[model samples]
Each structure stands twice: as C-alpha cells, then as structure tokens.
Target: MATAPPPKSQHVGAAVAEKATSHVAQYSPDEKWAERSRKAMQDAITNPPADAYAGRSVKNTGNLAIAFRSLNEILVRNKVRQTVRMTERHEKKGTKRRRLQSERWRKQFSNEVRKKVQLVIKIRNRGA
Candidate 1:
C-alpha cells in the first residue's frame, strides 16, 4: 500500500514565532553578532572583486619559477633515460664497455647542472 504524503503546515505556530522573536531580540545586543558584522564591514572595505587583478601589469613571478623547476626536472630525467639506453646498448658488447659508456654518460650529465643554472637565471629575468 502507498502512503499519502504529509500536508505542509500553513501556520507558523506560537512556539516557533516566540523562538524567532527571541532570536531577533538576542541579535540586537549580541557581542558575537556585532563582531561578525564589524569583520564583514572591514572585509567589504578592503577586498576588491576577484577579477580586479586579472589583466594588470603587476608581475606574477610564480610561473617563471615553476617553469624553471619543470625544465630542470625534464633535463635530469632525459639525461638519465639516455644514459640508461646507452648502457643497455653497450651491455651487449662487454661488461667493461658498459662501464666505460656509463662513465661517458656521467661526464655528459655534469654539464646539465650548468643548463639548470641558466634556466634559473632566465626565470628570474622573466619574472613571469
């Protein structure tokens, strides 16, 4: 059997009305409410719209830092990948040959540190 939906109440009962009256009365002299209102007024005075800084000439400086970090990570990973590939290729030739190949890769990786430094300099110059 289907149950009928309960009808909505049309009346605001005396108890509910009394409670709401008390709440409004409490709000008048409430320190907490006054503090909240004060803070809200201060925020309205200070904060501009979210889009206020959207197209301004001011510098971000964050993007450049992120770019430099990402580039450094890519360069390091690529160096490692290439070294691994070369080492695998040399392994078929001989163990000593693989060791020599890895040493060459290590020397190549040493130069990558300079590239990371250059990237940082470029990022600092851009200021994003």
Candidate 2:
C-alpha cells in the first residue's frame, strides 16, 4: 500500500512558517525596533498634548478631540515626511533630533490661557 499524503491544513501551515522565516531573515534588525516602536507609539498616542496649542482654549471639549485630530495629523505628517525625503537632501541625525526637540518645546503650553484636554481614546468598543 502507498503512504498517505499530508492533510491540507498542514501544508498551508508549513507554507506560512516558511514565509515568516524568510521575512525574519530579510530584516533581522527590525525585530527589536518593532517592539520598542510599538510601545513608544502606544504611549505617545495614549497621552496627547494639551489643547493650549490652539493658542487659546476658548472652547473646552476636555481635549477629547486631540485623540481624534492627532490621527489625521499623523497621517498627513507621514505623507509630508515621505514627500520631503524624496525631494530634499538627507538631513543629519542632530538636525532631526533638534527639529523634534523644538517641536516639543513649542508645543508646551505657555502661561497664557493654558489648559489641558486629556484624550484617552484609542481602540474603542471591543466585541460584546
């Protein structure tokens, strides 16, 4: 009698395993960075900046809008970064750090009409 062939699911599982292994080999360095980036991004998104950046907190929604607004801002920023990277010359590491630091400092609410609107809105309404 002839030997039986493996089941269909086993063949599919093996193919997935092989593909995952190949991707790992392709970018070994990205593995460690991926975890760190995920945690950092999660924290940053969870705790957003205050609404004082609007220059004045004339209308207070308790910062509930930051979580909503930041998502689109991040996407537009990503597109801007992609476009700038394609057009401009490569910038120095220090330049990138300085730019981010300046942004952080500028974003800090000044004494004038400073108010916070904490927005704790990330994945909402999980399955019942």
**Per-residue lDDT over 31-102 for candidate 2, one digit per residue giving the tens place of the 0 to 100 score:** 769988999999989877676343223343578588557655765755755766746887788998998798
TM-score of each: 0.23, 0.23
lDDT of 1 by residue, 1-128 (tens): 99775544534575577667886634455887888999999997787556733333234477887766666566575575576676675345577687778989998888797799899999999995
- Against the reference, the lDDT scores of all candidates come to 0.69, 0.64
Give the least accurate 10-residue stretch of model 2, judged by summed lDDT: 116-125
How many backbone clashes can be found in candidate 1?
0
> Against the true structure, whose lDDT is highest?
1
